[model samples]
Target: MGTMFYGDDSTALHFEDRALAHLKVVIATKLRRGESFTISWVHGPGEQRGRSTVWISPSIPLRFVFDDPEPTTLNPRYLDQLATSANSSGGIQLIDEDPVP
Candidate 1:
């Protein structure tokens, strides 16, 4: 598992390592371009049944922590999906990866 510590509040949002890596790339790219956006995800097991969203901006303090120690190989398709959603009016909505056959 990996964690994204966002903003001064340091709210931790958990995600799988691979997914988080891809998100890091997309988010960094956006922030580098001076863009601020929102990202949301559905709650996982053992948490509340609703979804959560956060505003992401270059001014905010953000950190990504991975448990694997080694960096993950990012999937371009997933990155594309995330980037597409990030540009949307609704902002980024984290979606599950396609199941491997």
Candidate 2:
């Protein structure tokens, strides 16, 4: 599994390659259509807390698959929130976000 983390001196954004790729595609498509989304993730030793968002454009294509058993549903409004958060944070990057074993 691979992970990436993006943040500054205060907070951080963490995500997995597979899930991120899927999210990237969704966000990119929305951006292409002049839309936005709110993507977020949490950061912690366990799966309890740690989340962040990123504003992505359609120009960016994600190349990974979500590793969870069940798939996540896509929501336009939710995506919008993610975009908003990403923009507010002065842009987001992969920060400690990785894949699982």
Candidate 3:
């Protein structure tokens, strides 16, 4: 599992390393362009019953920590889906990766 630390809060959001890598790319791109948006995700096991959303901005402190030393290969299709959601009014929604054939 990977950890994403957002803002000044000590609480950390955990994701799979592969997912975090892709999220980092899309988030970095948006933040680089000075865009602020919200990210939503469903809680996993041993967590809250529902979902959570947070506002992301260039000013906020964000960090992504992965368990693996090597980088995960990026999936264009997954990135596209994430980017599309990032641009939406509802904002980015973290979801499971599409199944590979």
Q: Which candidate should be chosen as best, given lDDT against the real structure? A: 3
**Mind giving the per-residue lDDT tens digits that candidate 2 earns over 35-96?**
54445455546566656555444444433334465555544554554455455544433333
How much is the lDDT of residue 6 in candidate 3?
94
- For candidate 3, list the clashing residue pairs, or say none: none
Per-residue lDDT value at 22 in model 2: 46
| Candidate 1 lDDT, 1-101, residue by residue in tens | 89999975458899988889888998999999999999999998988899998999899899999999988766778888999999998898999977443
- Candidate 3 lDDT over 1-101, as tens digits, reads 99999986596889889999999999999999999999999988999799999999899899988999999889899999999999999899998899655
Model 3: residues with Cα > 4 Å off, grouped in runs: none
Cα error, candidate 2, residue 91 (Å): 16
* TM-score of each candidate structure, all chains considered together: 0.92, 0.36, 0.94
* Winner of 1 and 3 under lDDT: 3
How many pairs collide in each candidate, listed in order? 0, 31, 0
lDDT of 3: 0.92
Rank the candidate models, highest TM-score first.
Answer: 3, 1, 2
